[model samples]
Target: MSDLNKLGLAEARDALRKGDVTSVELTESCLKAIDDADALNAFVHKTPEIALERAKAADARIKEGDAPSMCGLPIGIKDLFCTKGVPSQAASKILEGFKPEYESTVSQQLADAGAVMLGKLNMDEFAMGSSNETSVYGNAVSPWRRGNDDAQLTPGGSSGGSASAVAADLCLAATGTDTGGSIRQPAAFVGITGIKPTYGRCSRWGIVAFASSLDQAGPMTKNVRDAAIMLETMCGHDAKDSTSAELAVPNFEAMLTGDIKGKKIGIPKEYRMDGMPAEIEKLWADGAAMLKDAGAEIVDISLPHTKYALPAYYVIAPAEASSNLARYDGVRYGRRAHLAQGDGITEMYEKTRAEGFGHEVQRRVMIGTYVLSAGFYDAYYNRARRVRTLIKKDFEDVFAAGVDAILTPATPSASFGLGEMTEADPVQMYLNDVFTVTVNLAGLPGVSVPAGLDAQGLPLGLQLIGRPWEEGDLLNTAYALENAAGFVAKPGKWW
Candidate 1:
C-alpha cells in the first residue's frame, strides 16, 4: 500500500470498508509516513499512539456494524484549533505553553463523526504571516521539494503545514483557518484543494481568532471530494459562537453537482490587473477556456471596488485581531514576561505583550491599535467597513445579473522560493492576499482548486467566489474544472 500515499480519503475509506484494509493498518501507514517525512514538520505534535487507538476503535465499530460517516478517516487539525489534552499554540511563542481544556467545536464535531485526529499541525505565529516562515517553531518545510534544499518552496501560510501535509500525502485531509487567505493561499502553494467556506457556515467557537469577523475554519485536502466530506461534518450551528448563524447546514456532500453544462461563470474584469505575470494571465485565460469547453457561459463583469479590498481587509483584519488577541495577557495562560519590582500594572501588560507577540503579530497589533484609536476610528476602520459593504454589493449585483459564480486566479504567482517573500517589505506580503481576502470580508464562500502549473512546474490555483451561502454552485464548478484542467505535477526524484 506504499502507493496508497496519494489516494484520496474517500478511496481509502472504501478500501477499509471493503475489507481491503483496516483502519489500524491505514493509520500505521500514515504514522510511518509522518516519521519518514519529518523534514516537512507538518505536525506540531504527532500522536501515533492516540491515532492508532482511535483507528482500532473505528475498526471495532465497523466490525460491530455501527460506524459513523467518517469512521477510520485520518485528519490533521491546525494547531490554531484547540484539542482536549493536546497543545494548541497558533505557532507563537506567546501562547507557547497554553493548552485548552476544551476541544474546538469543529474538532469535536469531526471526532463525533469518527475522524481520527492525527495530531495538531503547525501554522504561522498567531496566524499572521503569508509564508510559514514566521512560526516560532521555524518554518514547516514543503515536503514536495525534499526538505530545505533545491527549490525549498513555501507551503503557504498560515495553513502552509496543512496544505503541505495534504499535498505530500502526510495526511488525508486537514483543517485550516482563513483570516486573510490563510487557507486558500497555502493550498495554492502546495498544489491541493482548499475551501474557505461561508463565514458563519463553520462555527468558529474554539478556533484561535486572528480577525474575529473574517476568521473562518475550513477543510484542506488533496481534492474537492475529500473537502466535501469534511465540510459536511464541520459545517453546523453551535450555541457557543453567538455569531454562528441559525440557518440550516445544507447537505454539502450530496450537493456537489457533476454537471456544469450551460451554467454562467463570470470572469471579473478587475482581476486582470496590469503588470500581472504572463504565466498567471495565461492560467486565468486557460481556466476560462476550459470552463467554456465544459459548456459554461463566460462573461466579463466588473467589481469596481476591487482595488480597495486589500486596504480594507488590512485595516479590518488587524483591528479585529487586536481586540481578539487581548485575552493573551499573561494572567490566564501562555507566556509571561519578567517585570521589575517598580514596574506598575501598565508596564506589566506592555512588557508581557512585547515579549509575547512576534514581529508580524506586533505589526498587526500596531495597525489594529492605530485604526481603532479614538481619532482614527472613523477615518480608517469605519471607512474600510463601508468600502467592504460596497465590495459585497458588487458581488451581489453580478450574481443578480445571472452569474452562477465568479472565477479568478488564487494568487498573483505560484509558489515562490521559501525566503523570497519574508525578505521583502510587509506590504509585498499583504499584496499576496489581495486576490482572496475580499471573499472573507463579504462573509461569502470561496474555494481554490488546482487550475494549472507555471512554467517553473509550480502549481497555480483558480478561485471560485460564490454568492453568500451558495457553496454548492462554487463546488460544482470546481469539480467540473478539476476534470477539465487536468494538471497534476508531483515532486521530482531530486530535491
Candidate 2:
C-alpha cells in the first residue's frame, strides 16, 4: 500500500471497508503526487486543507459500518463544477475570482457519499476547443509521450485536466463534462476510461453551461470498474435541473459481469472515413474482433447521416453557447472590466466580453450569434436543428433494428504534440471530434475504452455507443472490452 495514490476507486473503496488503509493516507499520497506534478498543469486549484478535513470525516464514516461504496475515495472535480467556497472558473478569465456559495448537484452527491475532493481541474475555456490550449490557466499536458521522444503532447480538451489527473494517478477518478467529445477524447489520449452517459442522466445544475442540450457530466477513471463505481454515485433525478431525467439510477458497478454474450454490437460503416490513419483502422478492426471473441455478434450497420454530424453540431452547440454566455456581463458575479468615464452600457458589455473570453470562445460566440440572427436563423440554425433530428433518427433506426451497441474508433490519431494544431486551420482541430460528436448529437450513452497503442506506443481507444438510458448494459460491454484489451500500460512518469 506504499503508493496508495495509484489505487483505483473500486480498489480503494474495498480497502477502506477492510480496514487496511486510512482515508488520510490515501489523501496525503494524492496531495503529494499533485504537488510534485505541477509540470502537467492538470490541477488549477489545490484544496489540501479541505481534502484532509474531508478525509478524516470519511474515515469516521467508514468506522460507522454503513458507509457508501465511495465512502473514502479521493477524486478530482472538474473546474466546470461549482463546489462551494472553491474556485470554479471553468478556466475562463471572465470567472477569474468566481467561487460559488452553492455546490453543483453532482459534486454534492459525491460529497454526501463521502468522496474527498482533491481540487478543481483545468479545462478549455467555457468548454470550447478540442485541445487544452484555450484554457486561461494554460494547457494540461498529457502524461503519455512518444517512444524516446521529448515533445510535450495535449491531453485533449475541455475534460483534459480530468483525464490527466486520473491517468497520472493524482486521484482515483475525476468528474468530466462532455459537450462533443470532451470526456471521451481526453480519456483516449491519456489511456483511461471515460463515459458520457445519456443526456439527462446526470444533473446539469451548477455546471457552467456550454451547450445546454449537449452537456452531460460523467466520470474519468483508471478502468471500467472504477468508472462504474464513480458514475453510479454521480447520477440521479434532480428537480433543480429541468433537463434531468426522472428515472431510477441503476447500480452500474453491480452490473459489470464482463459478459456480453448474445449482445448485438454494431460496426457503423460510415465511421470508416477517407484518410483515417491505418493504425486507427487496424485498431478499430481489432476491437471488433475482440468483442466477437467475447461471444458478442458483430454486425455491419449504416448511419448514413454521420457525415453531417460535425457541421450540424458546430452550428447548434455554438448557438446554445452564444445564448448561455450572454449572462456573463461585467455587472455579474465574475470579473468586470474597468470602464472609462464616457462608456455607455452597450460599450461596457462589448469591452467586457471582448476582454474576458478567450480566442476560441470569441470565435464560437460570433458564429452562434450569426446563426441565431433573424436573417440567417432559417438558413443555419434551423437547418442544423433539422439535421440533428435526422441524426437522432438514424440512431433510433439502428437500435430499433435490434443493435444493442455501436463501436467506432474513439479518435482519429493518438496524442499529438501540444502546439501542433494551434497554428493550423481551426477546422483541423474540429476534425478531432469527427468520431465523437454524433453521440452527443443523438443524446446517447458513449464510453471510450483504451484498446491498444499506435506505432509510437501512445494509447488509442475504441468507443461504444449504447442505447439511450442503458448505461448499465453499455458499461457491461465496456467491461468486457476492458478485460479483452488488458490495457495496463501507464506512462513512464516523465513529470
Candidate 3:
C-alpha cells in the first residue's frame, strides 16, 4: 500500500473494504503529498486535523461492513464549495475570511458517504477566468510540462487547483464546478478526467454562485471509473437548490461496461475551427477512428450555432454574475474595506467592491451591469438570451437525429505558459472556452477524457457531449475511448 495517495477512487475504496489499508494511512499519504506539492499552489487551505479525524471515523465505518462506496477515501474540495467552518473564499479577496456554518450539499453528501476532505483547493477568483492566474492565491500551476521545457503552465481555471491536485495524486479526486469549461478545461490541461453533469444534476446550494443557470458541480478524477465512482456520490436531489435535479441517483460506476458497440457518436463539423493546430486536428481524427474501432458509429453532425456560444455565454454569465455578486456589499459577511469619516454607505459599497474583486471579476461585473442597464438591456442581454436559446436548440436538433453523444476537442490547444493569454487582448482568454461553452448553454452533460498528447508531449482531451441527463451513456462512450486510447502518461515529478 505504499504511495496510497496514487490510488484512484475505486481502487482506494476496494482496498479499504478489503482491509488492505486504513483510511488514516491514505489521508496521511495525501496530506504529505499536498504538503510537498505547495510549489504547484494547488491546495490553498490545508485541513489535516479534520481530515485525520474523518479518516478515523471512515475506518470505523468500513469495519462495520455497511460502508458506502466512497467510504474511507480522501478527496479535495474546490474553494467554491463551503465546508462547515472551513475557509470558503472562492479564491477572491472579498470572501477572504468567510467560513460557512453549514456545508454545501454536494460536499455534505460526500462527507456523509465517508469521504475525507483534504482542504479547499484554489480556483479563479469568483470562477471568472480561463487561466488560473486570476486567483488571489496566485496561479495553480499545471503538474504537466512541455517535453524537456522548464516553463510553468496553467492547469486551466476556476477549477485549476482541483485538476492539478488530482493529476499530481495529491488526492484521489476533487469536486469541481463548471460554469463554462472550468472543470473540463482544467481536466484536459492536466491530463485527467472531468465531467460536468447536465445542469441541475448536482445540487448548487452552498457553492458560491457563478452564473446560476450554468453552474454544475462534477468530479475531476484520474480516470473515468474514478469519476463515475465519485460523481455517483456527489449527485442527487437537494431541496435546498431549486436548480438541483429531482431524479434518482443511478449507479454510475456500474454503468461503465465499456460497450459502445452500436452507439452513435456525432462529430460536430463546426468544431473544426480555422487555425486549429495540426496536432489537435490529427489527435481528433485519431480519436474518432478509435471510437469507430470500438464498434461505435461516427456520424458527421452540425451544431450550427456553435460560433455564437462564446458571445452568448460571456453575456449571460456576466449578467448573472453581476446580480449574484451584488450581495457582497460591506454590510454583510466577508471582507469590508476601511472607510473615511465622511464616507457614506454608497461610497463604502463602491470602495469595498473596487478593492475586493480582482481585475477579471471587476471587468465582468461592469460588463454585466452595462448589459443589464436600461439603455442596452434589449441590445445586449435580451439578444444574448435569444442566442442562448438557439444554441440549446442546436443540440436538441442534433440529439433528435439519434446522436447519443457528440465528440469534439475539449480545448483549442494544450496547456500554455502561465501568463501567455492574459498579456494579449482579454478576448484571447475567452477563446479558450470556445469548445466548451456550448454544453453549458445547452444544459447538457459533457465529459473530457484525455485522448492523446500533442507534439510537445502535452495532453489533449476529446469532449463527449451527451444528451441531457444521460451521463451514464456519455461516460460509457468515454470509457470506450479511454480504453482505446490507453493514455497512461503521468507528468514527471518536477514539483
Cα lDDT computed for each candidate against the true fold? 0.85, 0.95, 0.94
Cα lDDT tens digits, model 2, 1-495, are 899999999889989999999999999999999999999999999999999999999999999998999987999999999999999999999998999999999999999999999999989999997889999999998999999999999999889999999999999999999999999999999999999999999999999999999999999999999999999999999999999999999999899999999999999999999999999999999999999999999999999999999999999999999999999998968988889999999988989898899999999999999999999999999999999999999999999999999999999999899889974589999999999999999999999999999999999999999999999999999999999999999999999
- Return whichever of 1 and 3 wins on TM-score: 3
> What tens digits encode model 3's per-residue C-alpha lDDT throughout 1-495?
699999999889888988999999999999999999999999999999999999999999999998999988999999999999999999999997999999999999999999999999999999999888889999999999999999999999989999999999999999999999999999999899999999999999999998999999999999999999989999999999888889998999899999998899899999999999998899899999999999999999998988989998999999999999999997879989999999999999999999899999999999999999999999999999999999999999999999899999999999999987864699999999999999999999999999998889989999999999899989999999999999999999999
Summarize candidate 1's per-residue lDDT along 124-179 as a digit string, tens digits.
Answer: 98888888988888888775553334767788888988987888787789999998
lDDT of 2: 0.95
TM-score of each: 0.97, 0.99, 0.99
Candidate number of the best lDDT: 2
**Residue ranges of candidate 1 with Cα displaced over 4 Å:** 146-149, 493-495
Please identify which of the two predictions, 1 or 3, would achieve the higher lDDT against the true structure.
3
When summed lDDT is taken over every stretch of 10 residues in candidate 2, the lowest stretch is: 418-427
The best-first sequence of candidates by lDDT reads 2, 3, 1
RMSD of each: 1.7, 0.7, 0.7
